[model samples]
Target: MTSSSKTLGEFFDSFECEAFRLETLDDYSKSGNVDAYHAFLAGQPQPSDYNAGWVEELRSHTRAGKRVHRVHILSRPLTDYLSFELGWGYRKNSTGGEEFFILDITDKPNPLAGVPDFWCFDSASVVVMNYDETGKYVGSALLEPERVVEFTGYRDTALAEAEPFVEWWAKYGT
Candidate 1:
């Protein structure tokens, strides 16, 4: 395997036991309009019921001094997803001290130019290709104007290269 791939594999191996909560727009609908769906879910009788278990588990981890890492894969932009999930999780787990690490890969340039990348959301250590329209990726920062971090690459690579960022989050994210 390539060195980058190996590093990622090792990282995963170390955190294999870490529980991850995966929620996708597709889980609710194939139409892929997560914003609208989010609104719909909000109007539900128990809006926080869908991922209540996950929220509680995350809170538990936080209470025990474990940081909660969240990777959101989107077919559009990170801003909307982050806002929705973070807002919901925050509302549900108000007392929990949890840090969310989000890796949004919506409009990443292909490692090789001229080859069109697929437009879909997938996740492993981080969420990748969360938002792609016409096979073009856009970063979460672009989607959410408030987020200052720029999109560099896929989540896995970004994490591997961004040690300072990781460290900062680890140290102060909570």
Candidate 2:
């Protein structure tokens, strides 16, 4: 397995029996072209079982006092599809006294080909992203946000670009 996968596996294993809340795109329900945006905003029941293992793992980590945040970027078409079919929205989990945020990155324009960058999760005080020498997303790193910001000026850009997602999350996510 790749090192990233191994690291994630190790993290999960560390909290095997802990209890944490589950939040993901899968947590939302989907129908035809109408994502139950209202339902999601209202915190309705989950309608599907996809990503169950991932959900469990997240819950476990949070239970073990680890903050868990995730981001998924979708193509515009897929984003529309999700918006229409499922009530995909943002949701926050307060576990272990930590808040985890999730956002959809499909709408934002991609950075330049050689722009090295990272995302800083403020709640966790952790920076995570995949970067390469060519400025491509090649691997994920877990580090301090200040380091990423000081090194790449990515934090401000990320926060600005993420505003829409954050707004949507606040409105639609539980």
Candidate 3:
């Protein structure tokens, strides 16, 4: 696409084949679900409609033979927000055919150290996620085409050291 017309929304709408995300934060409580996170902290049950929009979007993509998956690099003793994200968000998002994996670096060095979180679409385009220290979503930067090789390497290395979320959660879920 031309620089004049490039947009994240357009990228999401146009990408084919697959979408991969890397999440390395312990808490994204301030991103989009402020109320839901508070409810989780306050002992409220997860609302049925939580994340309905994203779920439907995933369904639309997967239903069309596209893949949406993520690898979350996290450790044991998960934070409360991580708990909500895994037990509720991941679990619910799976219903729409999104895949989750966990790269537990609790006992070892991070192989993908210093790599910022990003989403690589169809192995071609990459949009790097930008966040504040408090885990707030600031914005995303679309990298130049020449840098896809670097991001693809990160994705491959992450997947190599990760396990499916269902299996890992079963063995170590809080």
Candidate 4:
């Protein structure tokens, strides 16, 4: 299918080699996995099935030698939502061979300031993820082919400024 006709979900299936996600928001509690987020806040142990479906999907791609990874731009003194996402979501997702990174801008200046969240598929297609003020996922916009270069640059910059999640978590994870 042409990239224009494919939804953001379809890009997940259609990407041949790699997928890269950039997460700028500090809280996405309202976007998904609300129950789990609530349980986390209650100090309850994470459920065994937490993020099971997404983990499996990551495995499917990774086992096939496809790569899926993301860099989250964040700072020290992480928000509650970030604590759950990184401590639970990211840690679990790693088991499926999905990679994670942290662009800790706590002390350093944000190089890609004002850049929105987006995904680049195989470095060919770009989809910008939109979220409301409260971190509710509003929608996504699939950019034209000409914009691929720009998004890829953003991805590269994030990766360049970020450190591996494992290492970052060890030092600063709550």
* After superposition, candidate 1 runs with Cα above 4 Å error: 1-50, 75-98, 110-174
Clash list (residue pairs), candidate 2? 20-59, 30-86, 31-85, 33-84, 34-84, 35-84, 35-86, 36-87, 90-173
lDDT string for model 2 (87-129, tens) is 3322322222333333344555543223333333333222243
Model 3 C-alpha RMSD vs. true structure (Å) is 1.8
Q: Could you tell which candidate, 1 or 2, scores higher by TM-score? A: 2
Q: Which is the winner by TM-score between candidate 1 and candidate 3?
A: 3
lDDT of 4 by residue, 1-174 (tens): 123667788999889999999999999999999999999999999998889999999999999999999999998899999999999999999989999999999998999899999989999988899898888998888888888898899999999999999999999987
List lDDT for all candidates, in order. Answer: 0.37, 0.38, 0.91, 0.92
Q: For each of the candidates, give the backbone clash count.
A: 9, 9, 0, 0
Tens digit of lDDT per residue, candidate 3, span 67-134? 99999999888999999999889999999999999999999999988899899999999988889999
Could you give the C-alpha RMSD of every candidate to the true structure, in order shown? 12.1, 9.6, 1.8, 1.9
Per-model TM-score versus the true fold = 0.34, 0.37, 0.95, 0.97
Estimate the TM-score for candidate 3: 0.95
Per-residue lDDT over 48-81 for candidate 1, one digit per residue giving the tens place of the 0 to 100 score: 4655555565566566655444333333333444
lDDT of 3 at 55: 93
lDDT of 3: 0.91
